[model samples]
Target: MKNRSVLVSGASIAGPTLAYWLSRYGFDVTVVERAPALRPGGQAVDFKGAVHRTVLERMGVYDEICRRSTGATDMVLVDAHGNERARISGDFTGGDVEILRGDLAAILYEAGAGHCAYRFGDSISTLRETEGGIEVEFENGPAGNFDLVFGADGIHSRVRRLAFGPDEHFVRHRGYYYAIAGEPPHREQSDGPRRRESYAHNDAGRLAVGSGAKAQQMYLFAAPEMHFTDEAEKRRVLTEKFTGMGWQVPEMLAELPVLDDFYLDALARVRMPSYVAGRVALVGDSAYGNTLAGFGTGLAVVGAYVLAGELAASEGEHIVAFARYDRIMRRYAKVGLGSSPGPFLAPKTTYGLWLRDRFLGSRWFGLMEKFAGDAKDDLDLSGYPAWEAR
Candidate 1:
C-alpha cells in the first residue's frame, strides 16, 4: 500500500468524498473545515449520467442517497400572480436523484468519518511547501506537515490564494448573486407531486426555488458583485433586492435571519492555469467550480473520485496524479465552467426573461434533458478501479 498523509480543506461534498477514497487507498486523510459543524445550507444538488451513479455506487452511498432523495419530479415556474408559466420536470433537473446539498455532505461524512480525521471550526492559515511535504498551520489548531494538501475549499478558497494567488485572479463573477436558507415548508403553495414550487419575478430578476419538508429557499438575482462581510448586511442586501417581489419572497426573506444554515455567495467559476503547485493540489469548487451556474455537485464529486484514483494509481506521486486529473477534467468541465446560468436563471431584461420562458415552454426542455444526460457521461471513469476495493 502507498502510505501517504493528505490534508483536505472543506467538509462539504468534495472534501469528505476525497477523504473516503484516499483513506481506502491506504493514505492518511485529515479534513479541515471553517464551519463549527457540517453546514446544512444550500439547495438540492443532482447526480446525473452513468459516471456519477457509478461513483456513488462504488462509494457504497448510492442507496442511502436514493433513500434521502427529494423525490421532486416537477418544478412549476410562476409569475407574480402565482400563474404557472413553465414547468421543469425531474427528468430535467434531478437526473437520476436529487438530494439537498447538506444531506449529501452528511452521508459522505458518515461514510468517511470512521476512517478519516475531521477538524471542524478551524481553517488553514498558512501552507509552506518543502521537498518532503507541505507544512500547514491552522487558524485555531496546531501545525502539521502532510505529503499533500488539497484545496477542496470552494470558489473563495484560501488554499488557492496561499498556493496560487488571490481569489480575484481565479474566481470571476458571472453577473449574478445567490442565497439559500431553510424555511418552514409552505405546504399550501406546493404545485407538484412533491410539496415544491419555483417562483420567478421576471421583471425583477429574482428566482425562488424550494422543495420537500423543512424546505430551502434558493434566491438568485442579476447583479454586479457587492462586498458585504456582515450577515446582517448581506441579509439587508437580499431583502432590498427581492423587496416588493411576489410569490413567497417576503416569507422567504423573513426566514433568513433565523435560518441557522443561511448561505450567500456570488455565482462564479474558478479558473486556474493548473490545479497544483508543488505538493499542494486543489479539487472541486476550488479548481473548477461554476457555482450554481453549472451542475457542480456532480462535477465536484467526480473530480474527487478522479483525483484520489489518480493519486493511488500513481502510488502517491503528485505530479503524475495532478496532471492526469487536470487533463481528464479539463474538457469535461468546460461545458459547465464556460456556460453561465446567470442569464437563464435571472435574466437582467424583460426580453431576456421572455426568451427564457419561451425556451422552457417549447421543445427546448427535451434538448435540456439530452444535454444533462450527455454532459454527465462526458468524462470517462472506466479505467479507474473502484475506490472502495482499493
Candidate 2:
C-alpha cells in the first residue's frame, strides 16, 4: 500500500487506537506522546450503545475491557445538610461500561505496542508538508517524514494548531471548568460498599462529587475563560472557587495539596469544518471533543477504526481516505456537540439546581437517557473485510 508510514500524535486514547488499526492493516506506525510515561489513574470514561461495543469487539479488547470495568455507580445528589435530594443512575452517567482513562489507554497501548513504535516524553514541534510526505520535527527526538500524520493529541492539540490554525480558531470554552483529584490515602477503601455509590454536593454554581471514601473527587464550577500557568495556580483557583462550601467540600479542598493526580482544565469543545488538511488529519478530541460530554472515548475508538479502515480500503491514498474519514466521523461525532455537561452538573442558580433535581427525579430523565442511547448508536459503521486482522 502507498502512504503506509503513519505518525500519530498523542499516546492517549485516540493515538494508540489509530496506531493499532494502522499497524494491523500493514502500515508502519509511530506514536508520540508528550508525557514521559503512560499517565495512570485518570477520571473514569465510558462506552455506551452498540456502536461503541462493536468497535471494542472488533479491536479484540472487549473482554479485557469488561474485565477491568469499573461498574457503574449511581450518583446521589445531596444538599448542604447531606440530605439526599435526587439520584442519577449509573446507567445514565457511566454508560454501558465505565473504566479509568489510564486503564483504557494502557489496554489500547498494549494491543498496539507490539506492532507500533511508541515515543514517550516527546512531541511534534513542527510539521512541514513536502512533495514526498509530511516532515515532522519532535520536541526531543530526530525529525522524520511520514506518509500521513494524525492529531489525536487533544483539544489543545499541537498538530491541530500547526496544521490548522490557532486554538482560538477551533476550541471554544464552554463557560465552565472541571478538576479531578484523588486522595491516595483513601484509595484502598475505594471498593468498599460505601464507595460503590458516588455522592455529589452542589452549592449554587459549584458541584463537588466524591467516591464515598474520598478516593476520587470531581469538581465542576461555572467560570469565564481563564488560564493557569502551573498546578499551583490550578490548585489555588480550585480552592478559591470551592472553599467554605458544605457537605465535604471543605475536606475535599483540604486534601487537594497532597493529592498527586490533580488535573484542571476548561470544559471546552472543538469545532471545525473538517478533520483533514492535506496530508494531516485529526481524530478523537482533536477532531470532535466536548470535555466531559460522556461520548468522547467511544468517538475516539470508533474514529480510529474508521480512519484506518478507509486508508486500507483506498490502498493508502490519504486524499481519498482522509476525505472519507472526515465525512463519516463528522456525522458520527455530532453527538459531542449536543450539550455541555457543566451547566447540567453544576447549575448557576438555586432555581437551576432545583430544576435539575426535579428533572432527575422525574420521568423526563428516562426519555433523555433514551435519546442519548439512540445518539450513541446513530452511525452506519462501514466494514472493511480486506483490512480485518489475521
Which residue pairs collide, candidate 1?
Answer: none
Task: Summarize candidate 2's per-residue lDDT along 17-55 as a digit string, tens digits.
Answer: 999999999999999999999988888788999989988
Could you give candidate 1's per-residue lDDT for residues 46-128 as a string of tens digits?
88888899899899999988877765556677787778877767567666787777779999999989999999999999999
Per-prediction TM-score, please? 0.92, 0.96
Error of 2 at 180 (Å): 0.7
Deviation in angstroms for 27 in model 1? 0.6
Worst lDDT window (10 residues) for model 1? 184-193
Q: Using alpha carbons, what is the TM-score of model 1?
A: 0.92
Off by over 4 Å in 2: 183-195, 212-214
Runs of candidate 1 exceeding 4 Å displacement: 1-3, 184-196, 209-215, 251-259, 386-388
Residue 29's lDDT in candidate 2: 95
